[model samples]
Target: MRAPTTPLRPQPDSLWRAIAAPMSTGAPLARDIDVEVAIIGAGYSGLSAAYALQKRGVECTVLDANPIGWGASGRNGGVVSSKFRLSFPTIASTHGIDVAKRMHRLAHDGVRTVEAFVDEFKLERARFEHTGSLRCAHTERALASICAEADWVRTTLNDTSMSVQSRAEVEHETGSKGFVGGVLSADAGTILPLEYVRGIAAGLNARGVPIYEATPVIDMSREQDGRVLLTAPGGTVRAKQVIVATNAYSNLTEATASYHRELVPFRSAMIATAPLSPELDAQLMVNRRSYTETRRMMKWFRNVDGRMLFGGRDAFGKEGEPTGFDALQRAMVALFPQLKDVPVEFRWSGYVGMTFNALPHVGRSDDATTFCLGYNGAGVAMASLIGQHAAALALGEKPELALLAQDGLRPVPFHALRAPGVRLVAAWYQFLDAVGA
Candidate 1:
């Protein structure tokens, strides 16, 4: 109904931007062009799809409202977890064990996909690390579930790399007594997410895929010959196929209005501490592993380049409000009492797409348009894998993974009231988590 404004720019002091390598610039779309595929959004999903398409000798062009990786792809916590937003048992119960197993395997492969990309492209700046991840139990009741899930993963999935830690073990490994216990997954790890996405963009650029920055697709129309005509600010693209990969930052164009309504975007905020002293680092994060608590409204943190970067829910606070940051700081101090006096160097926020079913989707929105989005905060690994799948679908090939084919996008009920509804849901979850209900 209204023109889409330019996406917000990344904060100048964001840790990712501060450490990011200089990026090459791409000119905006200057004139009309024709291609086999046109990809909107240059984040991980779109860039990954473009890369995959190029590998298959397909012609595709990528367009972004902002520079590549300007969204959650760059501002995220960098936890390369090979898991869905929903729990494994929940997925199994809902989708059957066979489908659940397939989904698990797909997630595992998603992690490997990132590993392969880093290695094949020699993304030295990505600073990819295989340090593993910990899912800490915030309460004693959560510890039981954590242990049970770890056992299920080991026995059912035959994943020997995952194990449940006892309370003492968790405290010893994390140097924090706040966690009752945890599940350690050695296959999971972390990476410089921004660097990884930028690396993919660079690789795609090298392969001759024109990436148009500051080029927002304003509208899309179907041509008589079944092509999709995408109109941007500077020019137009007539493509045989279109892939909508905008995710949380999706604009409400006529082409994407219905699908965009299916996604509920909530702000996820983070704070990075000034470099911790080596002794403090050792005292706090003994294993330097990425970690997230087992709470519905969760907190995630990791030791990144000698600093502690942490994030959590921001549903209760607006963009400029300090409520979210204050809560995060308190949580950080509660976990590591020694960090109560630590200085926070950076604070920022980004939108994460939440789906009604709490699972990411990838499929055809229409005969000529395909999409991959709604990661529900687990975008790092899932987005990359889904992007590749979207590329396959674009080329008229079946996706190798069946996870994307399940639970296609459905608009949330009372979509117009989503903001207040999400805030209420967040408050309820917080209360439940607080009371260990």
Candidate 2:
């Protein structure tokens, strides 16, 4: 395969970025300044933290290495589901059942938090839809797991919003017979992710929190008096407290190296088809719910404005390059052959931060520095919530989620080998998925 002559664009071409409403990200920081709190990322978590801090009447500034929503926050498939990579049973087995309940509730709260932001800011352009989410089973084993999960959600959590669906029901709902069966959760939904995050930034700007794009924090240090100093190319910020919310892009700078070591950043590729015909839209995703198949390396898609937005954990060749569009297209065609002739208008990829624990981590790295990341592909809703948790932690308030409140940055063992390790694990999962293991 021939590599592109040019390196990847700072922010690759994406469906969301192309159609999102315009919003200014402000000029980069160009002079020394002091603030109560400083945030180092313009993505969902950092922006959310800035919003929470400003609400508390604390002065804060957000800095980013690129334009606003340039990371996974802008590149995701716009699925606003509050589900985590781990299942309820796994969480209950690790923590107690009560803890598992709290985690589940917290996940739901994440979804509500985004909705609250939309209502507060009147972000109609965000195009949020509370139409719920459907998880289809790709195999018999997966079908059993989906049914068990739906049962746990209904009986144990007392959440009547979740239900299991038969294969025929799944086909009728999704217009695709590729799935064996499925589970539906009314607590989930969909949104224009880039629009949502950018809307948050706009609201923050109006509320006096300045977000500086193209301003990367290159170095960080602690003062003798417990204040944190972040040095950027054009200026330096001395803040009483700092929240690092860079997520998978944390490794781009030595300043966030410690946080980077804790995560296994995996690339997720996506594709979007040109607007589907009314008939095609009606046939596929009739209810406009976020849809995913139950596979170790899963595929997710949804209907957005009569278009099919599809994505998966498939990437090839070099990092930051657009090399997996064909694979994603093949997957989409396999599921919906009718779409095989549809024109693909967008192809992009972004990193998702994964942790060894398979759960997001939030806590202080030091007295003046706090961090929240490792969403494992659930960043849209979870990041928005955890950003607030990181802000509360910086302000000396306890985080609402007990699991995160007790957790700190746990570095991966032998972090240098993450690339090869991730590849090996991904190949193993793909093989298992292929053979129905």
Highest TM-score against the true fold, candidate: 2
lDDT of 2: 0.87
Please list the C-alpha lDDT of all candidates, in the order they appear.
0.83, 0.87
lDDT of 1 by residue, 249-301 (tens): 77435556666677888888889999999898877667878899988888999
User: Per-candidate TM vs. native?
Assistant: 0.95, 0.96
Tens digit per residue, CA lDDT, model 2, 1-437: 22112222356678887887665546777888999999999999999999899989999999887888888898888888777888877788889899889988889989989999999998899899999999999998988988888888778888888888899999988888899989898888899988888899999988889888878888899888888899887788999999999999998778898999989888899889999998999899998899988888889999887888899986855555767788889989999999989999988888889988888888888888989889999888899888998999999998677566635667899999988888899899999988987
Angstrom error of the Cα, residue 260, model 2: value is: 1.0
Off by over 4 Å in 2: 1-10
RMSD of each: 2.6, 4.1
Distance from true position, residue 289, model 1, in Å?
1.4
Error of 1 at 372 (Å): 0.6
